[model samples]
Target: MKVEDITSSEQAIALEDQHGAHNYHPLPAVLKKGKGVFVWDVENKKYYDFLSAYSAVNQGHCHPRIVNAMTKQAETITLTSRAFHNNVLGVFEKYATEYFDFDKLLPMNTGAEAVETAIKICRKWAYEKKGIAETEAQIVVFENNFHGRTTTIISFSNDEGARKNFGPYTPGFIKIAYDDTHSLEEILKENKNIAGVLIEPIQGEAGVYTPADSFIPKVKELCNAHNVLFMADEIQTGIARTGALLAVCGKCDCQGHCERQATYSRPDLLILGKALSGGAYPVSAVLADNEVMNVIQPGQHGSTFGGNPVAAAVAMEALEVVRDEKLAQNARKLGDLFRSELNRYIVDSSVVNLVRGRGLLNAIVINDAEDSSTAWDICVALKENGLLAKPTHGNIIRFAPPLVINEEQILDCVKIITDTLKQFEK
Candidate 1:
């Protein structure tokens, strides 16, 4: 059958199972189109996109501004490679650096690549600037962190499924407990070879685990005291997903001038992705001031399509959408409402234990064991009831809708979610 003629969800699933890699186990709903806060399945069933493509569609699906920028740039010059100077690249770099209050930005194609780039920059800065011996720099990471699945990244991962048979792992990383400031302090005091401490402001894949408010500031203080680079991996929590422009912004949702906010704990190295292109295309970036960024000379690191014109245009427009729509403010206001509404329901709930998260990135913990299928079953039921969410770990379902969702829409979603949970109540 012709691809366009194949309209059934079963047909699409069978085709993927036959021709595609068996890597992802997606929801049964085969989506064919999406708008601001809604998606349509192949069968024309509509559902609220609670996942937002793992927080990549913060500007909403097929955002007109981002799409227009991408299409316009594609029409002119999609790629010139870093060999020749592209007009849009430098403009985007300047805009983004100023927007995020950084001095420089190193663009890449994916969140994983940006993370790897940050690692390279950190190690190089340690060797050249911090005076660490070559190959002796050790970076600290948190347990249950979800960076990406690159060989070097997965090497430090604790996920057995991702690590099994994927040895030997890369060295020079020290894993520590998440949200433990004392351990970080002890390690920083003991280890002089430490180059950087990489952390997610919120551990998204580990079930929207929001750390203590004091945790991030203490980490920044420790990194400052030890002369180590503090790298924040905001791939999933950035771009206003966490109520603020960046998760590290704490409670402030100011458009810019993050340094002026007392709640903001600035990271030396900032890694951003997912929503960088508003889910329109691949674009990720590593941002830092000149002192740390200058360590990498030209030809040391780059990608063929890293800073392409299309990516530049799309990313610029995407970030603009965030500011123009006041998505950070929207996320903050709605997130509080979301959690409050869920908490009210949880008081009498037997299936859901609690709801926790910042902004639109929230999760509900099922009262079942982590190995149980209860969360998955509820997610399937949510899909059937006109909402789309996914289970992480096993008993946790993350609910991060587009930042564009309104209060009325969110209330409707809450009803759908609560009604579905009632079906599985113990």
Candidate 2:
């Protein structure tokens, strides 16, 4: 069959299996289009997009404002790499740095690259400013963290699947328990060579494990006491997904930047991605104050498409959509409703153990064993029942619909989700 004429989901899956690498084992539903919080499969069957492209579509899919900005810039000029300056890049950098209350911003094309950039900045700051010996500065990370799959990142990862064959792993990392401040303090006190403490306010990939309310505050305090940089990787949890501009904003629901909020736990290095361009384009960034960021000199780090005009325009518009549409406020209100409704059903549920997350980023732990296929089967059923979700770490399913979803849509999704889970109830 001609590729253009292929209309069946089976045909699409077969084509991918034949031509594509088996790096990702996605759900069987082959989606053709997306708008707002919904996606249409190849057969024209519509389903709620619970995953939101792993929280990349926080402003919703194919948002007109972001799309228009991208297309407009593409038509004007797409790329003028760092070998020379571009007009839009400076504008985006200024807007983004001001938006996040950072002194500077480093642009990159993907989450993994941003994480790598943060790592490089942390280590360089250690040597140049912190007075740590070269190659001796170590960054502390939490267990069950998902920073990305780069070699340096996987070196410190506990996931055997991602790390098993990808060694000899890079060194200079210390792993500690999540939400444990005593361990962090102990490590920092014991090791004067520590450069930074990297954390995810809510571990999205590790089954949406939300840390204690006091956990992050204490982390920032400890980092300050030890003079270590506090780095937050908010790739999946930022951009209104956590009901705030950034996950480190905690419970603050203000429409403005979180710098002045009492709940804000400002990070020295803030790594963001996924929804930065509203899923219209690939855009990720690392933000920092001058003290922590100025360590990197020219000819040190950059990407070919890092600050392309298209990325600049799309990201600026995407962030504007988040602010103007009040998505963070919406995510906060709906998240509470979503959890309340889910809890009403989970109280007596034998199939789901619990629900946990911040804002729209949430997960339900399956009662079955981690190695069991029950969660995957339930996800397939969810697709059939008119909603789409995917399982993580075998038995935990993440549900993060677009922030554009309204009360009625979220309630409808909750019903669909609870009803689907009821089918597998013991």
Global lDDT of each candidate: 0.94, 0.93
Residue 112, model 1: Cα distance from true site in angstroms: 0.4
For model 1, how big is the CA root-mean-square deviation?
0.9
Model 2 misses residue 349 by how many Å? 1.1
* TM-scores for the candidates: 0.99, 0.99
**Tens-place lDDT digits, model 1, residues 1-426:** 786887899999999999999999998989999999999988999999999999999999999989999998899989999999999999999999989999999999999999999999999999999999999999999999999998999988998878889888999999999999999999999999999999999999999999999999999999999999999999999998988889998877576335679999999999999999999999999999999999999899999999999999999999999999999889989999999999999999888988999999999999999999999999999999999999999999999999999999999999999999889877
Clashes of 1: 0
Each model's Cα RMSD: 0.9, 0.9
**Per-residue lDDT for 1-426 in model 2, tens only?**
775687999999999999999989999999889999989988999999999999999999899999999989899999999999999999999999999999999999999999999999999999999999999999999999999999999999999999998899999999999999999989998999999999999999999999989999999999999999999999998988989999998987687467899889999999999999899999999999999999989999999999988999999999999999999999999999999999899999999999988889989999999999999999999999999999999999999999999999999999999999999997
Candidate 1: stretches off by over 4 Å: 253-257
Error of 1 at 270 (Å): 0.4
| Model 2 lDDT on a 0 to 1 scale | 0.93
Instruction: Give the residue spans of candidate 2 off by over 4 A.
Output: 1-3
Cα lDDT, model 2, residue 254: 83
